[model samples]
Target chain A: GIQVEQSPPDLILQEGANSTLRCNFSDSVNNLQWFHQNPWGQLINLFYIPSGTKQNGRLSATTVATERYSLLYISSSQTTDSGVYFCAVVNGNKLVFGAGTILRVKS
Target chain B: GEEVAQTPKHLVRGEGQKAKLYCAPIKGHSYVFWYQQVLKNEFKFLISFQNENVFDETGMPKERFSAKCLPNSPCSLEIQATKLEDSAVYFCASSPQTGGTGNTIYFGEGSWLTVV
Candidate 1:
């Protein structure tokens, strides 16, 4: 089993601000994904980056597999971005998840 | 359209009652996973299936929990004699196959279960 830790457990930001959330894993992973759980409790997949960098609109993520760390960046954030961001990794057969970073983007 | 579809967006059951949840993975997906999220905490893996075979179920509670995935039928997770602690959001996810590298798992909206 792999251990995952997320930094800055809580964050508050005004609209248009930028922030970076990080996830650190204890072991090598083959699958890495970033998810956003909305206020209504819907889990939406944001990124599935096991390595390299990827961007989708205002959200981007980079995973350094060798370093066993991943970073999620939100640019020009909107109020709709307020929610809990989760980082999940798969070491072997099971997917391990971090506690998540709660972000509040005030309009 | 959502890749994974879970039935009964919300469920309420009395303690000691049996609870059953269903999940239908995306077409062509071979792997299906079930996770439980309590409050705002991280997801707890329960079980997974690859096609019609059970792949991994180490996270399942041996006593009151069981799951099945039959061919041409939707996958199911059943909890017998449910307890108060069983109240949580049950999420169903699916992927093309298993392995760490490059596999992307998609999740359903989740079924909220309240045991009283």
Candidate 2:
């Protein structure tokens, strides 16, 4: 089994600010994904970066597979980004998830 | 469809009752997975199927939990004699076959189950 740990278990920020969330895995993984669980309880895919970097709108993610760590950056954050951010890695055929980072952005 | 479609966004069951959730994976995706998320925030894998055959079910409970993905039908997760601890959000996901690499997977909106 693989273990995934997310940093800064909880976060609060004013709207328009920036933040970075991190995930570290205990073992090698071939698939890594970042997800945002909105207030409505929807798991939205933010990025699928097993390695390298990718950006979509105000969010970007980088995965250093060799280091077994991944970083998710939110630029000019919005209140809509408020929720739990989860990083998960495929362990065999299942996705092993981190405890998640809760983000709350104030107006 | 481009997204995984799960039925009955929310369900309520009493202890000892049965609960079932359904999921239709994105069209053309051959692999389907199920995961459970408790309010405490940890997501646990439950089971998976490739086409109509079970793939990996190491995370499923010893009893009362079962799942299936048959041809031309939506995948299903069934819980028998539900307990209070069975309350959680169940997520269904799918991925294109990527050999053994276990590539990217997309998740549905999740079915929220509450047991009383």
Candidate 3:
């Protein structure tokens, strides 16, 4: 089993602001995914970076496997981005999730 | 285009009653996973199935939680004699057999279960 810890348990930002959320894992992982749980409880997959950098629209993520850390960056945040961001790592056969970083983007 | 379909967006059941939830993985996916999210906490993996066989079920409560994935049928998770703690959002996800960065896992909208 792998332990995942997400930093900045809570964050508040004004629209157009930028934020960076971090996830630290205890062991090496084969699968890593970033998910956004919207206000309505939909777990939207944001990125699936295991050990590289990837960008999708206003969101981007980088995972350094050797460092055992991952970072999620959101630029020009919008009200729709207000929600909980989760980092899940697959260790062995199951995926373990982090506590999540709650973001509040005020418009 | 790729989506995991879950049934019963919301469910309410009395204590000690049985609760069942169903999930249909994407057409080409071979792996299905079930997770439970309580409040705003991290999701807890309950079970995972590779095709029609159970791959892992380490997080399931041996006494009350059981799941099945039969060929040509939707996967199902059943909780018997549910308790108050059983109330949470159940999420179903799917990925390909050769999972990695290339094969990203997708999740369903989740089913909200309230046990009173």
Candidate 4:
């Protein structure tokens, strides 16, 4: 099984602040995705980046496959952004997830 | 449908009972995937289907877990003799799997199961 490690197990920030989350995998992957688990338990897809950089509004992500690492950046955070963020990689036939980074944004 | 749909958002069962969950993948999508979130932050892949056929099911517990994706119907995951640890949020995801975009997967709101 492929191993995934997320940094800064937990995070707290004020609304409108900025933060970055990281994910590192032990093996190269064919697909790498970032997700935000909402309060209601919906796993929202943030990014599906195997390599290179992508941005969607205030959220952005970059994957360095060669280094087996990825980074997610959230700018102008909102109270709605408080949730758990996960990075999962496709290991052969399945998607292996990291433990996740818990984020709390206070207004 | 634009997104995956799961039925019975929450379910409660007793130990050794049978529990089942259902998911309807997006229309026209050919790939369906199932995942289990035990704790708030941990997710485990359960199975994946390429259309109506099983693609990979390495994460399923052979003795207690079974899944099926029959044509013209929603996919199902069944756990017989459910244990306390079987309590978790089961999520269903799907992708169009067309062109170069098939690898991107989308998830549903999830079905929460609890064993008391």
**Number of the predicted model whose TM-score against the real structure is largest:** 1
Name the candidate, 2 or 4, with the larger TM-score value.
Answer: 2
Winner on lDDT (1 vs 4): 1
The parts of candidate 1 lying over 4 Å away from their true place are: none
Model 1 — TM-score against the truth?
Answer: 0.97
How high is the lDDT of residue B66 in model 2?
95
- Clashing pairs in model 4? B97-B102
Candidate 2 docking quality: incorrect, acceptable, medium or high = medium
Could you say which candidate leads in DockQ? Answer: 1
Give TM per candidate: 0.97, 0.97, 0.97, 0.95
lDDT score at residue B37, model 4, on the 0-100 scale: 89
Tens-digit lDDT track for model 4 on B1-116? Answer: 98899988999999999999999998988888898989787888888999988988888998999999999999999999999999999999887773113278888999999999
lDDT (0 to 1) per candidate: 0.91, 0.92, 0.91, 0.91
Tell me candidate 1's TM-score on chain B: 0.94
Per-candidate TM-score, chain A: 0.98, 0.98, 0.99, 0.98
Which wins on DockQ, candidate 1 or candidate 2?
A: 1
- What ranges in model 2 sit over 4 Å off? B99-102
